[model samples]
Target: MLLAVVLASVVFSAHAQSVPKPKEFYFDEDKTTARPIVVVEGEGEAQVQALVRERDRGRRQLEATAQLAHIAFSDGRTDLGGQLYQQALAQTDAKGTLGRAVRWNYAWDLFRAGQVEPALTRWVEVASAYGSPSWAPPTLALALWRLDRKQEAVAWFGAAVRTEPAVWIDARNFASQLPDWKQEDRDTLAEVLGAWQANPPTWP
Candidate 1:
């Protein structure tokens, strides 16, 4: 009888492990893809460990795959992260908030690794997924600028400037405007803004 109780307790503990509920965990308040890359240090070790266990067992369901993919990136396992991100995206609605969040984080991971062109593609997909979300133009502008696509960059900048010209024109506002971006990203966007001011895009 005592043995049966111990076995049942073990089974209960196994079944009681918390299932991950992944919403748009990587998006900004603006519902745009965020820039901050995931790091193992950002989450609880317990949660990370659980996600890894799920990943190894191939038991990662749709949203759980997203969480494990994020953890994989945080663990510096880039290839594994990419694979898992692909798997999650395949299983989820690619146009949904959760899907965008996964793609955004994947793009960020690529961008951080200096794969800017691929990152740009993913960002463009996300930017166009909605009615050109307010948060995208600035980041897109800077990325295009970085790639020497000056005209396109300026056009993207124009969208942002139109929305918040007062904010975009001043360098002081950039740090606050892009609170989620790294200092380097903010600086590059400032450069793009400066060039756009020198010769604004032509339009109606």
Candidate 2:
């Protein structure tokens, strides 16, 4: 009996060890999940610096500049992020996916820095141009709410819900932060929240 119990414990321990840990996802300032940054193994900061050097030498300039911009934004260096984004945009096709991504990240940096107006403008651009990503509308709605545009904010909030049901929890949480929302708007948000709670969207 003692030997059997010990074997059972070992088996349990082995099974637990075999289970992989879930990957942690990070959100940007607007609570939008950030894209994963890929770094070369064993190179670390040296690899990023080498990429920047390669950009300066005009080899893979667009990719290098964008990656450095993302790193700067992730590190909270908005000034460097802005400059790098501009450099990348100059070399990228403004109507393409990469351009939209750079613009979105730059807008997020602006939002983090409290440049709400410009951030709103850029977010509007991103929504109009991309229109598919799940993050943009809710983020834009939060910006509008911050700027005291409650009506427009509520409209965008609904738009976000319709566009991405998976974001209902985040949108509801964000709506709760708007202290000056009218009672009617509050009621509307409450209804949406209750519905979402009852029928939660499946994770992608």
Candidate 3:
């Protein structure tokens, strides 16, 4: 998830196929699952510099810019972050795995910034991608909940526990397990978990 973002980030060479593996930059090495990479708050100094160097040289240009954008977003620099994300995405393959990861970061940032509709819209693409993360159902549920789509929200929560059988059974587990999720998101998921527990989905 360590990509760069600059307005000049799109100038790619014909030999630009050396796409970096982004997971290396998604979080600190100790993280079990990915969370927002907050550069301004004591993490990822080395990786961020690496991205800047790569961006300067136009290597994996699009992805470097996107990753930088994520850093900016994490620091609450929303407008700059969004601009960088869009610029990098202009050359992105939305159907590709790399692009999905970028979309996930951007969508979550949008969600955090209270742009639910667009966030959910981007998530629709990510959800349909091959190898979508198991953590997705709760995210979908919370987004639907925020939009007042309660039935859909609860059903998605049910879908989550049906797969893991226990992982998302209690919202309280969410804090430790999903360390990257903001508290509001966890609370929203808790609401979904409660609703699902009350009336689990029944197949028609």
Query: 18-100, model 3: which lDDT tens digit per residue?
Result: 21111111112212222443223334788778877767785577777877898877788999999998986677677765676
Model 1 CA RMSD to the hidden true structure, in angstroms: 18.3
Instruction: Tell me the tens digit of each residue's lDDT in model 1 across 106-150.
Output: 777767767677777787777656554677777777777777777
Per-model TM values vs. the true structure = 0.72, 0.57, 0.72
Q: Write the per-residue lDDT of candidate 2 for residues 123-190, one digit (tens) a residue.
A: 66655554244565455556666665554555555555665445455534544454434454455555
**Candidate 1 local Cα displacement, residue 144, angstroms:** 0.9
Candidate achieving the largest TM-score: 1
Could you give the C-alpha RMSD of every candidate to the true structure, in order shown? Answer: 18.3, 18.7, 12.7
What C-alpha lDDT do the candidate models reach, one value each? 0.68, 0.58, 0.69
Q: Give the TM-score of candidate 2.
A: 0.57
Query: Number of clashes in model 1?
Result: 0
Worst window of 10 by summed lDDT in candidate 1: 17-26
- Backbone clash total for model 2 is 0
Clashing pairs counted in every model? 0, 0, 9
Candidate 2 yields a Cα-based lDDT of: 0.58
Better of 2 and 3 by lDDT: 3
